[model samples]
Target chain A: DTAVSQTPKYLVTQMGNDKSIKCEQNLGHDTMYWYKQDSKKFLKIMFSYNNKELIINETVPNRFSPKSPDKAHLNLHINSLELGDSAVYFCASSHSTANTGELFFGEGSRLTVL
Target chain B: AQSVTQPDIHITVSEGASLELRCNYSYGATPYLFWYVQSPGQGLQLLLKYFSGDTLVQGIKGFEAEFKRSQSSFNLRKPSVHWSDAAEYFCAVGPFGSGSARQLTFGSGTQLTVLP
Candidate 1:
């Protein structure tokens, strides 16, 4: 079974359109995260939720919202997507809420906005 | 702010030769360090991590890293590399805390090319 999975492996949408990416983890982890990898291959953390509680919210714009309905799932919804939103979004999870844990990442969803 | 720095953007090596990927970091305290590898069209995989204990940490696929507090660096190394080992390597640093540390600051990845 896949430990961490994300839907919509590839997304191509027009500007101003709204989109959502769903993520699920079966590792029974408490912390789930959303990361964005730009064209330069720089992975930056956008948000993190621990046990369904919002914990880390980076400098991401308000247009990006992360919802953690439960400990096993964390989804990302982008409103008013623009050309700058084109990048690879990855969903990751760790076994514990502690920072010492290693993250298991999903295959990542490539989003291309025109 | 915590940050990870990977000096080389790309490196080419010969198969059966050794490999070392450099990674430096800037953090307040002893930070949680990690090395991850990503193949083409795949998610990142953890090669190794360092929390506290031994400075030299061993990881899967014959990979290892040594954390140096004096240098503020965690460098990944392998004795012999196969063609399959060619991938993008990333160095990341987490804060020193229970909850906040999960927010990782990753360096620009280094791409490895193995020549015949």
Candidate 2:
């Protein structure tokens, strides 16, 4: 069984379209996060949810919104997708009590905005 | 403002050769450091982490890293490299306190290639 999984491994859509990426973790973690990797492979945190509560909101655009239906699921929705939004999005989870930064990540979802 | 830097954008080494990847961080306190490996088209896997105690830490896949507080460096090392080890390696740093951001600041990854 996959510890962390994300749906829509690849997404290609026209500009101004709205799309959502779904994530789920079976690790029973309390903290979930979304990260974006740019063309240059520079990864940055976009959002973080702890037990369905928004904890870390990076300097991400307002068009992007993250929703956590429950502790095991966190979904990202992008409205009016722009060309700049075409990047690999990754979902990760970790236990807050773990002193390590060991995050379980899902195989990234590649988004291509036309 | 915490940040991580991987000076080398790419590294090439012959199979069976020794490898070392350098990582430096800037933080007010002793930040938690980590090394992650990402295969092509796959998510990142944690290689190792350094929090306290011994400066050197061993991890899966025969990877090891030494945390040097004075230099603010945590470098990854492998005695013998294999072709299968070719992948992208990233260095990340985060605050030490609980309930803190725990948001990691990742470095621009270093792509490693194993030469034949």
Candidate 3:
């Protein structure tokens, strides 16, 4: 069983189109995160949720919104995506909101906005 | 705020040769450090982490990292390299205790190309 799974492993859409990526973790973790990896392979944290509560928002654009319906799921929705939104998005989960735990990451969803 | 820096953008090593990837971090107090690896078209995998004592921490696939508080470095090392080890490595740092941001700041990854 995959610990962390992300839907739509690959997404290709127009610049103005909107898309959503869903993430679920079976690890029974209390914290989940969304990270963006740019073309240069620089990974940046976009959002984090702990037990369905928004814990951290890294000053991402308004177009990017994260919703966590429950503790085991966190979904990202991009509105009016731009060309620069072409990047890989990874969903990860940890035991808690503390910094000492390890993050189990999903395979990742590669998004390409044309 | 915490930040991580991976000085080497790319590294090449021959199979069976030893390898070392350097990682540096900046923070006010003791920081939680981690080393993650990412294969082609894959997500990041935790290699090793430095939380407290035992500066030299071992990880999966015969990998180890030493945390040096004096130099703010947590460098990963492997005795022998395999072609399968060719991938990107990332270093991340986070605040250790409470009353701080609970996010891991990752560095610009270093791509490893193992030669035959």
DockQ of each: 0.61, 0.61, 0.52
Superior by lDDT: candidate 1 or candidate 2: 2
lDDT per residue for candidate 1 within A1-114, as digits (tens), equals 999999999999999999999999998888899999999998988998989999889999999999999999999999999999999999999855465657889999999999
Clashing pairs in 2: none
- Give TM per candidate: 0.93, 0.96, 0.95
- Candidate 3 is scored at a TM of 0.95
Candidate 2 residue runs with Cα over 4 Å from true position: B99-101
DockQ category of candidate 2: medium
Taking the tens digit of each residue's C-alpha lDDT, what string does model 2 give over B4-95? Answer: 99999999999999999999999988798899999999999999988899999999999999999989999999999999999999999997
Task: Single out the weakest 10-residue window by summed lDDT for candidate 3 chain A.
Answer: A94-103
lDDT of 3 at B61: 89
Residue-level lDDT tens digits of model 3 in B11-93: 99999999999999998877888899999978889888888989999998899999998999999999998899999999988
Writing each residue's lDDT as its tens digit, candidate 1 over B15-66 gives: 9999999999998776888899999889999998888988999999999999
Query: In what order do the candidates fall by DockQ, top score first?
Result: 1, 2, 3
Q: What DockQ does model 3 achieve?
A: 0.52
Give the alpha-carbon lDDT of every model. 0.91, 0.93, 0.90
lDDT of 2 by residue, A74-111 (tens): 99999999999999999999987776667889999999
Segments in model 1 whose C-alpha atoms lie over 4 Å from true places: none
